[model samples]
Target: MQKEIQIAQLITALQKGDVTAFDQLYFEYAPLLYNRIFKLIKSPEIVEEILQEVFLKVWNMRAQLEVDRGLKTLLCRIADNLAIDHFRKASRDRALQEELWTSSVGFYLHTEESIFDKEKQRILNEAIQLLSPKRKEILTLCNIENKSYKEVASMLGISANTVSNLLVSAMKDIKNYIHSKYEGA
Candidate 1:
């Protein structure tokens, strides 16, 4: 009961933009949060980065925070969401890298037997240019620049899911364009 009152008082102070209260809260919860995040991320550097982002978000959105809910629960939810976001991004990046590598390797091997590398590159460029501007941007960031969906989404002021969907569509279109143009020739 006493601890609850302390937590309530901390929340009230935090909502009022009290840095000391924020620090106190961080000190009280960061370790537990770090452990939870580390279990999901499995990298100390990434865990630290996520923890910082989570607290920064909390501080930035303090005015909208609801003290009625348990602070620990709120923090844990934020941490979990961030960790899941990281996992999704890592997974997407790995898959994209593998696909790009595989395609590049096949193209390289095929080019060794023929002098069609330049033509193939041109065709790929043309196929990319056929996409919508936003889709082009997604492909550039995600495939060319090797950025994560979240990074691309943040850069484009869209949701990560939007970035993902656009990338899938763009990749499919590019593949179809290339196949139709080059398959029978």
Candidate 2:
């Protein structure tokens, strides 16, 4: 009963912005609060940090202090809430980091495949370039542009049979060129 009266006086003094009373409150309650917080969070560093934050919150909100209830209860509640918040934030950060790592790995695989495809295209283009101009034009129109033999023959002023023969020869030459180059490598 006597201790309660002293604490009530401290609370009233604190509401009026008495620094000495606030110091007394800290000296009296901080250790108990620290132990309570440490039980929830096993790190000494985190416990110390949370203890300071709890006291800071109390000091900031001293004007609303309710002397009728236990001040220790209020302090413990604040410390517990802050510790839970810290754990929630840490969980969210860990999940976000894992998501980023997965995305980067997927991007790396896509990039590697894209590079390989570009190299193969370069090699095929080189082999096509080695053809005679007329053969290259015929093959490009028929295969690359998806034109029919008749369409290519009409565009190039040749017979459809001539276009077909030229395409067959062009395909054979391209296949031989690719096989020779890659086989040697």
Best-fitting candidate, scored by lDDT: 2
Query: What digit string (tens of lDDT, one per residue) describes model 2 on residues 144-169?
Result: 89999999989999999999999999
Candidate 1 achieves a global lDDT of 0.93
Error of 1 at 134 (Å): 60
Candidate 1 residue 73 Cα shift, in angstroms, is 0.6
Q: Report lDDT (CA) for all predictions.
A: 0.93, 0.93
Per-prediction tally of clashes: 0, 0
Which pairs clash in the backbone of model 2? none
Off by over 4 Å in 1: 116-185
What ranges in model 2 sit over 4 Å off?
172-185
Instruction: Give a tens-digit lDDT track for model 1, residues 119-184.
Output: 788899999999999999889999889999999889999999999999999999999999999777
Top TM-score model: 2
